[model samples]
Target chain A: MSRRGLLIILSSPSGAGKSTLAGRLRQWDDTLQFSVSATTRAPRPGEVNGQDYYFSSVADFQDQVAAGDMLEHARVFENYYGSPKGPVKTAIESGRDVLFDIDWQGAQQIKNSDLQEHVLSIFILPPSIKELHRRLVSRGQDAPEVIEKRMQKSWDEISHWDGYDYVLVNDDLDTTEDRLKTIIAAERLRRPQQPHLVDHVRKLQSEFGDRP
Target chain B: MSRRGLLIILSSPSGAGKSTLAGRLRQWDDTLQFSVSATTRAPRPGEVNGQDYYFSSVADFQDQVAAGDMLEHARVFENYYGSPKGPVKTAIESGRDVLFDIDWQGAQQIKNSDLQEHVLSIFILPPSIKELHRRLVSRGQDAPEVIEKRMQKSWDEISHWDGYDYVLVNDDLDTTEDRLKTIIAAERLRRPQQPHLVDHVRKLQSEFGDRP
Candidate 1:
């Protein structure tokens, strides 16, 4: 039997490198699937409907939520966004690991759901707040006031770091990516994930002597 | 601050190749310390004191046990053998991982002790009982009856495989060793194992704006 896939949840403060690490992991293992979240918001100019987000009507999103189609959902600035249970179930059942690039609240909801045992949550930390601020400034997209607002929100995100199963400090991008891959490889070998062991053990039992 | 070392307990039945893997791990990382057990049995002519075993009188062994200096101890056919707490404590505090080659019973005792949080237990399984038997027969030093007795005990060992934190099938020695190293590397990054992270977070807090 094929091993069941893990639901990998990666969360971090805005300047931390979770998105970069997630992208690297996908590049490393092409078979892994990235979760496409359903959202009520309008698609951006360059965004594809199903590939970027499962763009949906507000009524349709609510209906799916009520029908238990969402693994986890949240309202953000009058827009509903969620991870659909159907696609994740199909992916994992077919032995494809799904990656989630959601925040801590979404991670918590999925962890508390029925699929808690399959979740592997990781939190990435910026090496220092000075570095975090420097990175935000280097982006050059945000004004000074906006950068300060983001700095405030970063701590709010970092406060929930303890809730994760594994924590990584993204001081060096390559090293952090390597560590994340190692974590995924090890989690795949967990006993409950490998049901084929039952048959292997049964074969061993048949080979035992009758003297016992 | 130095990270505390993990107490790695590797358990496997006879012919499962745990010993060979353990030796390879030590060779792969020379910093890892092998746990030398204490015993009440008389030392052999070639045995070096403290290097081979901390040879002790039965009364001395009992005294150490009563004093809570033994991490896990057992009596087998009137001889006492145990993991001493002192060496392991010193090694871990100084940032040296210790390897324990013990049975399931010893593993259980160490896992239940005060140092439970520091322990990482792995159980190795042979790919098949036929393969395990073949490995034993190929050794050529053991008589047929002795090999049969070991085969009986192998089943008993395999029964407790679920109790380990990680399980690996010894299908390929190199692959199993690589997986073991990966598990250890990821485990070292766990938040509780890295106390210096507290200082890192505190620095972040100091740099935060008073906007909250």
Candidate 2:
């Protein structure tokens, strides 16, 4: 019998390199399926319906919340967003590990939900705050002021590190990615994840009686 | 301020490919150190001193036992074997992850010892018993009768799968090995493992004064 897939929640500060590692992990492991969150915010240019996010109206987002269909929902800055329980549950039941690349608030909400036990939480941090600031500025994505704001926000994000089951420091990109890959592989091998394979091993043993 | 290293225990039946994986992991990450077990058993041919096993004497072994110097020890099939407490403590204190390649019994003993808090148990299994049997027979070291005995022994080993905190099936050696590498890397990044790194990150924000 196939077991449900693992729910992997990965959280990291803006410059901690989790997004890159998560992307590489998905590229490396075919079994992993990314969790697409639905948000009330308007899609930016080049954002696809299913690729970037599932765009929803404010009322629709609230409706999912009231209907208890969203696994975790929150209002961030103005817009409401949530992980739809349907797609996540379906993917998991089909034997694909679903990855939730989200923040602490979202992860905490998921943890409080029924899906908490299935969740494997990981929080990633940069090796140092100097490194975090350097990486953020080097990216050239944000103005110095905006980058400074993100640095401030990182502490608030990282403060919830203990709430996660695993933590990672983005020391070097390649090594950090490699480490993420190992955690996923090891978790998949966890006994709860492979009962069928264990039974298969037993059946094979029974076939070969000790031939002394 | 260095954080503590994670104590990872990997238990698997013979020929399940843990030794190779452990070696590769250490090769990939300089920070990971393997726990060299101390034993009273005579070293086999080609075994180097302090490499394959820390060769010790019966008298010294007894002294250690009396002093409770071992994290775990046992008399197995006519030999006394134990994991020494001193070096492991030092390695962990120095901020290096230690891998324990032992059987379930040794893992249990280590868990029962003071190292339980740091221990992360992982059990590896072959994808199928048929595959495991094939691997055992191909080695050709065991006679046909001995192969049968080992296959039988594998059944007993498989029974303890539940005792592990994580399980991995060695279905594809390369893939599984890569997976294990991630597991170790991720566990090392745990929050408790990097308290100093947290402080280091915070210190940068204070130095930059919201500018950098």
User: Which has the greatest DockQ?
Assistant: 1
Q: In candidate 1, residue A43 scores what lDDT?
A: 92
Model 2 in CAPRI terms: which quality?
acceptable
Candidate with top TM-score is 1
Fnat, 2 decimals, each candidate: 0.67, 0.67
Candidate 2 chain B weakest ten by summed lDDT: B203-212
What does the lDDT read for residue B206 in candidate 1?
76
For candidate 2, the iRMS in Å is: 4.1
lDDT of model 2 at position B203 = 62
lDDT, candidate 1, equals 0.88
Which ten-residue region of model 1 chain A has the weakest summed lDDT? A203-212
Residue-wise lDDT of candidate 2 within A58-144, one digit each (tens)?
A: 888888899989988888899887899999888876778899988898898888888666778888867777777788889877777
Model-by-model DockQ, in order: 0.57, 0.38
Put down candidate 1 lDDT per residue, A9-62, tens digits, no spaces: 999998897778888999999989999999999998999988999999999999
